[model samples]
Target: MQSSFSPLVAISPIDGRYQKQVNELSGYFSEFGLIRYRVRVEIEYFILLAEKGIFKMPAKIKPAQLRAIYEEMSEADAQQIKETEKTTNHDVKAVEYFIKDQLHQLGGDEVAEWVHFGLTSQDVNNTAIPLLWKEAVEESFMPYLLNLIATVKEMARTWKKIPMLAKTHGQPASPTTLGKEIMVFVERLQNQIDLFGYVPYAAKFGGATGNFNAHQVTFPKHDWVAFGNEFVNERLGLQRMQFTTQIEHYDNLAAHFDTLKRINTILIDFCRDIWTYVSMEYFKQKTKKGEVGSSAMPHKVNPIDFENAEGNLGVANALYEHLSAKLPISRLQRDLTDSTVLRNIGVPMAHSFIALKSIEKGLGKLLLNETKINADLENNWAVVAEAIQTILRRVKFPQPYEALKDLTRGQEGITQKSLHKFIDGLDVADKIKNELKAISPQNYTGVEFDY
Candidate 1:
C-alpha cells in the first residue's frame, strides 16, 4: 500500500503502459479488492450463523449496521488490514481480527468472537475469490466480448454481398462473399462463448480438508453439508464443490481458464486473418491526424491495433493455459503453490481485457477496400473452375474434375475467353456448356449465408 510506483515505474505493462485499458479489473483482483471481498464474505458468514440459530444476537447490535460493513469499508480500513497482516503473517486471520475489532466498536464485543468461527482460511478465500471472478466476468469482461462479437456481426452484414477470391493453401481456389468469410469467425466464437456459460463458477466451502470438520464437531447435529450447499449456492451465488482437500480442487476454475484460452486462441486466429487482409489491400486503416505509423516513413499506416491484439492475446492465452494446467493439480491435502498462483489469476484477465479493447479498436478503424476486393474477384477468373466442374459432375460429364484440372491447374492466365472457349469445345450438350460459361468468378459465390 506504500506509494513508490507510478505507471512509469511499474514493471508489468498491465499496471503501467496499459493500466487505463485494464484498470476496470482492479476492483475485483487487486490486493485491496481481495481484502474487501474477503471481509464481505466474513461478515456474510457471521450473519448466516446468526440466521441459523447458532447464537443469539447481541442486544447492543443493529443488523442494519452489521450488513453495512462492506459498503462502509474505506481505503483506510483496507490499509489497516494490511498492517494487521504484517504482524499476523496470515491474511485471512488478519481479516478476522479486523472484523472483531469492528464488532467491538459497534457495541457488540459480546459476539465479536463469532466472526470467523468454524471456518478455515480457504472457506473465506475460495468463496471470496470465486465471487469476485463471477462478478468481474459478468459485469466487466462480457461487455467487451459482446462488443467485439457485435462488431463482427455488423461487418458480416455490411460485407455480405461483396465477392472476393478465396485462398486455399495459398492459391486462388473458389469465390466467397466477404461477409461469409467474416461470419466464420463469428460462428466459431459464438459456439465457444455459449459453452462458457456452463462452466460452473464453483467454490470449496467445507472447512480445512473440505469436510466441515469444525462446524460438525461444534454443533454435533447441525446438517452442516446442507448448510454449506445452501450458503454457497444461495447466499454466495457460487457453486459449492461437494468435496475437496484443504483447498478447492479448482477443477471448475481450471475449466473456466481453458475456456478462456480457447476464446483467446480464436481471437488470435481472427487477428492474423485481418492482418493478412490489411496486408493484401483488402482493408485499409483510418488514421489519426497526428499519429505516426513509422519513425522514418511518411506514407505507412500500420495495423498496430491488430498487432497489439495478437500480442496481448498470445500473452493472455499463455497464462490461461498455465492456470488450467497447474491450478487443478495439488499435493495431497493441498500445497502453498496454489495460494501464490491464485493471487495472480487477475493477470491473465487484465491482459485479455486489454486485448479485447485492442480488437474492438481495430475493428472500428477498418475501412473496407471494396475496389480491391472486386479487383481480386475479377483477376482470379480461374476460381470459377470449381463451380463449372461441379455443374459438369451434376450433369454426368466424363471426368469433370480432371477436365477442369487440365484447364485451371497452375495455369498462368485463364480468362473469361479461355474458359468460354473450352466450354465451346466441350462435347457436352449446348445447354450444359452454356450454363458452365455463365459461371464467373464475380458471380460464383456460394449460396447466401447469414447468422
Candidate 2:
C-alpha cells in the first residue's frame, strides 16, 4: 500500500484513470469483493445444510449468529482471510478457515466442522463468480445500455421528420429521415438486447466432477442433485448446469460474452457513423470553454467522445472474444487455464463500461446541423430518380429505369430541373407526370414510421 493511492501508478486504466467513473463496480469485482462473496457463499451453504437437515445445529448456536458471518463482513474480515490465504495457498480454503474461525468466535465451535463439508473449491468459485457477475450485469451494465437506448430513442423522436441525403456505396442514393437512420441502430441494439435476456446466467454446483460424487458418497440417502438444483436456482438465483467436470462448462457464460460482443460491435458501428457525420458537417459538437481538440489546430472541435467510445469498445470486444473462445474449452476434468482467465473477466466489463460512458457523452454533445443536412439533400436532387422510376412503373411506362439511369447515373450535380424535364417527356397521363415532376430529394423519403 502507498502513503497515498494514485492513478498514475496503477497498471490498468480500469483501476487507474477511469477508477472514479467505474468505482461502483468495486463492491462486486475487487479483491475484497471476491473475498466478501466467497464468505457469503460459505455462510449460505452452511445455513443451507442446516435447513436441508444435512447438518444439525448446535443447541447454543442461533441462526442469527450464522447470518452475521457475511452480513457483518468488513475490510478487516477480508484482510484476515487474505492473511489466511498466504498459509493455505488456496483461496477457497482460506475462506473456509475464516468462516470456521468466525463460527468458533460465535461460541458455535460444535457447528464449525460443517463450514465447507464435502465441497471442492470450484463449488465456491463457480457460485460466487456467477453471483457476482449476475449482480454486476443487473446493477451496472443493463442500466447503461437502457439509458443509452433511451437517449438515442429520444434523439430519433426529436429528428423524425428531418430529411437527410442517404448514401449507398458512398454515393448519394434515396433520401432518408435522420430519425429513420438513427432508428436503424436502435432496432439493431434492441434486437440483440432482447436475445441477451434469454441467455442464462448459469453456474455449476456439483462437488468435484459435476456429479455430486462426494455429496452422494457421503449421504447415500440424500438427493444431492435435487438439493443442488434447488439451492443454485432458488437460493442463489442462477441456473445450475445438470452435468459438468470439475468446473462449469462455461457455455452460457461464453454466450453472454458473445452477446456483449454483438452489443459492442453495434456501438462501434454507431461511434464510427457519428464520427463520420461530424466530419461531413451533418453534426456539430458542443465544445467546452477550455477543452482542446488538437494541440496545434486551434479551430477544431473534434469528435473525441465518439472516438474514445470506438477505441474502448474495440478493446472490450477483443477481450470478450478471447473470453468466449477460451473459457468454454478445458482439458479432461479441468485445467488451471480457466482459473487465471476468470479472474480478469472484470477487465473487459470495465472497458465496456468506459465505452458506454463515452458514447453517452458523445451523444450529449451532438448538435444536429440542420442547415448542412438539408443542403446535402437539396444538392443531391438525383436521389429523386427512385421515386420517379417507381411511379413510372405504376403507370406501365417502358424503359423507365433505363431512362432515369441514362439521365442521372454518373451525371454530376443533376438538379430538380433536369428530373422534371425528364418527367415531361414521359408518355404517362398528365396527372401521373405531374406527380413525378413534384418529387425532390428532400421529399423522397419513403413511408414514415411512428418510431
Candidate 3:
C-alpha cells in the first residue's frame, strides 16, 4: 500500500532510515550545499579578480557592496543556483550564469563575462569540496572525535586503580587495571587523530588538462599559475595542487580516509572490549525505564549501545576503505566516477558521527562493578605466580620460575591459601616469603594501571 508520503526517497541510508542522526550534515553535503559552495567559489574568484585589478570592474562595487554580496548568500540564493542548473544542465555553467545574474542586479554586468574566466568545472568543484570538507571537519567531526577521546580519558582516570584479572588467549594470565586498558585506546586514537591532522585538504585549479591552456592564451603576460595558487591556498584556505589532471589527485583525501579508518578500527576494538567486560560482569549497564532490552527475555539487559557503536563503526570503516582506495585511482586525466563518489563523502562521516554518539551513550550507561572486579581478582590468586617468581629471581632462588610454574600450571582453582602455602614451603628467607604473601592478584597489577 502506498502511504501518504512522497514517492521520492533517497537511495542511501544516510538520507533515509538514519536521516535524523545525520540531518545536520546535509547543510554541508546536499545538492543545495553543493550549489552554495559553487557560488561561494565563483563569488570569491570574482572578488579576487577585482582585488587584483585583472578586470576593470565598475568602481561602484565598494568594499561594503562586496561584503554584502558575500554575506547575503542565503538558502534562497542557493535555490536560485539550483534552478539555474536545471536549465543549463551543466553545474559549473549554471554557477557562472547565477553569478552573472546576481552581478546584473548589482549593476556589475559589464564584468559578468569574466566570472568563470579560464577555468573548468574541476576548478570550482575541487575548491568547493575541500572547503566543505574543511568546514565539516572543523565544525562537526573533530569536536565529536575529541569529545570521544576526552570521554575515554575520563574513564581512564576514573578506573586507574581498579584491578582486574587479565586474560591471554582466554586464560587467566596476569592482572591489569581497567584504567590502563582504556588508556590504550586513548593513546591509539590520539596518534591516529594526529596523523589525520597532517593530511592536507588539497584542491586543483589548473584549467581543462592542468596546463592552464586557455588562461595562458587569454593573457600570456599574466602568471595564471601563481594567481591560481594564491586564490586556492590563500583565499580559499586549501592546499593547491599545482600539477594535476582535470580533477585533483585526491591522494591527501585518501590519506584522510585511511586515518579515519584507523581511528574507527581502534574504536571498534574498544567497543568489543567494553562489550566483553559487560558480558563478564566487570561492568553493569544502567537500566533505563521503559526501555526494552529484549522482547521476550525478561532478564535480558543487552549491551545495545556498544553493539550499535560497533555496527556503525564497521559500516563507517567499510566506506572509508572504499573511499581511500577508489578516490585516488581515476581512469585518466578525469572521469565522472569521482564526481558521483565525492557527493557521498559525508556518508562515511555520518556513520562516524553516529558511531561517536552511540559510543558516548554506551560510555554513559556503564556502571563499573567494583565488587565483580575485586572478586575476579581475588579468585584468580594463581596470577601472582609471576610476581612471586620474579621476586625469587631477584633473590637468586634456584629455578624460581620453574618452581612457580610447577605449583600453578594446570592447577584448577588455585586459591590464595594454596599459593601462600606453597610460598611458605619455599626455601627463601622470611623477607622474601612475606613479600610473596603480599603479592596477591588484587595488588599485583605492576605498572599497567599507574596513570
Candidate 4:
C-alpha cells in the first residue's frame, strides 16, 4: 500500500523518531485503537443488556453470528468510523452511528436504539480508555518490565561474589559485591512492580454529571448503579467509580501515572549507576561491528546506551508527572483539557518503552571487568579500617575506633602490608594480631554475597 503521511506531521517524537519501537502499542492507543475499544464497549454493553433481560434479544444470537459482530470489526471498520467522524466532528457520535449501522445489518434495527442506551461520550471514553490501558499494561508494559527485572536478577546472581570498591560522594568508601549492588535495583524494581500490579484500573460509568440522571429519569425501575458496577468491573475488567462529573474524576488514573513515574525514576537511577560503573572501567561495553561510538575519538567506547536510557526515562517521567497532575483536576463538572491531555498518555509510555529497550541493550553489552574490580579493591586498602576497628572492639581494646582512624584515615597507599605491619606493632596479643591480619579489602565486603 502507498502510504500518505498525515497532512500535519505529529509534533511529538512518539509518532516521529521512536515510533517503530512503540508501534506495538498503536493497537491500544491510536485512533484505530479508540475505535476498536468503542466498538468493544458497545458490543459488550449490548450483550450485557441482553443477558440482564433489559431488552428482549433475538431468540438466539448464534455463537457464529455473535462472533461475526465482534470478529468483523477490523481496521476497515475503524476507518469507516473515522470517515463518519469527519462529517459529525464528534468522535463518540461517530462510534454510536457506526455501531447502529452494524446493528441494522444484523437485522436488529428494533434494538439499535439501545446501542449506547443512556450514556454520555465520557461513559464510552472512560471505559474504553481504561480497557485499552489495561490491555497495554498486561500485554506490553508488564512483560517488558518483568523481563528487565529478570535480566537484572540474573546479573545479580552471576556477579554476587565479585567484590568491587564502593563509592560514596564519588569517592571510594568501602567494598561491596557487584551482585549486591545489582540486587539493590532488582529489589527496588520488584517492590514497585508489586505496587503497580495492585493499583486498580478504574473507570467512571454513570451518565452525564455522574448522577445517572438521564438513565434514572428514563428507566427509574432499573438499578443503574448495580448495572454500572457489573458492566465496568465484570465485563470490562475495570473498577467502576460510582460518582463522577461529565467525565471520570481520573484520581485512579493519576495514581497509575504517578506509579509509572516512580518506576521510571528508579530506572533512571539504575541507568546512571551503570553508566558511572562503565565510565569507571568496572564494566566494559561489547563492541558491535560497524557501530561508531564517537565521530572523532576512534578509541571511545562511550556509555551511550545508558545515556540514551537515562535521557528517554527523563522525558517519560516529565510527561508522566504532567499527566498525573493535570488529569485529576478538571474545571467544575468537566473540561476539554483532559480530553486533549489524555491522548498523549501513550507518548510518555512509548518513551518509557524506548528507555527500557535501551537499558536492555546496554545490559546485554556489559563485559564485567573483574581485573579492574580486583585492582580497585587492592588499591583502596583504607577500606579495611572498618573491619579492623570492629575486630579491635571485639577484643575490648581501648579507643579501637580512634586507633584505626589514626592508622588508616587520610592515609593514601595504605596497602595490605602497611595495615598488617600496623597490626603487628599493636600491644594486643598474637591471637589479636592474627585475627586482624586476616582482614583485607577483598574480603571486607561483609555478608553481601551470602545469598
Question: Which candidate ranks first by lDDT, i.e. highest?
Answer: 1
User: Using Cα atoms with residue i matched to residue i, what is each candidate's TM-score against the true structure?
Assistant: 0.97, 0.97, 0.95, 0.96
**Residues 1-451, model 4: lDDT tens digits:** 1125552476877777776788898888887777788778878887888788888887645435644655566777778888999999999999889878876777778888988888899999999999999899899988999999999999999998888899998888779889999899888888888888787999999988898898899889999999999999998999998778989878888888888898999999999999889988999989989999899989989988889989999998999999999999989999899998988888888999999998999999999999998998999898988888888888888998999899877778899888888888888999889988887788888775554
Where's the lowest-lDDT run of ten residues in candidate 4? 1-10
* Local distance difference test scores for all models: 0.89, 0.88, 0.86, 0.86
Q: List the residue pairs that clash in candidate 1.
A: none
Could you tell me the lDDT of residue 435 within candidate 2? 84
Tens-digit per-residue lDDT, 1-451, candidate 2: 1124687899999889998878888888888788888888888888899989997887777777777877777888888988998999999999999988888887777878798888889988999999999999999989888989999999999999999998888888789999999999999999998998998889989887888877888899999989899888988999999888989989999999999999999999989889999999999999999899899999999998888888988998999999999999999999989998998888888888998998999899999999999988888988888788887888888978998899888898688777777778878899998888778777888899998
User: How many residue pairs clash (N, CA or C atoms closer than 3 angstroms) in each of the candidate models, in the order given?
Assistant: 0, 0, 0, 0
Local accuracy of candidate 1 as per-residue lDDT tens digits, 18-60: 9889877888999988999999999988988898998887866
Error of 4 at 301 (Å): 1.2
Q: What would you estimate as the lDDT of candidate 3?
A: 0.86
Worst 10 residues of 3 by lDDT: 1-10
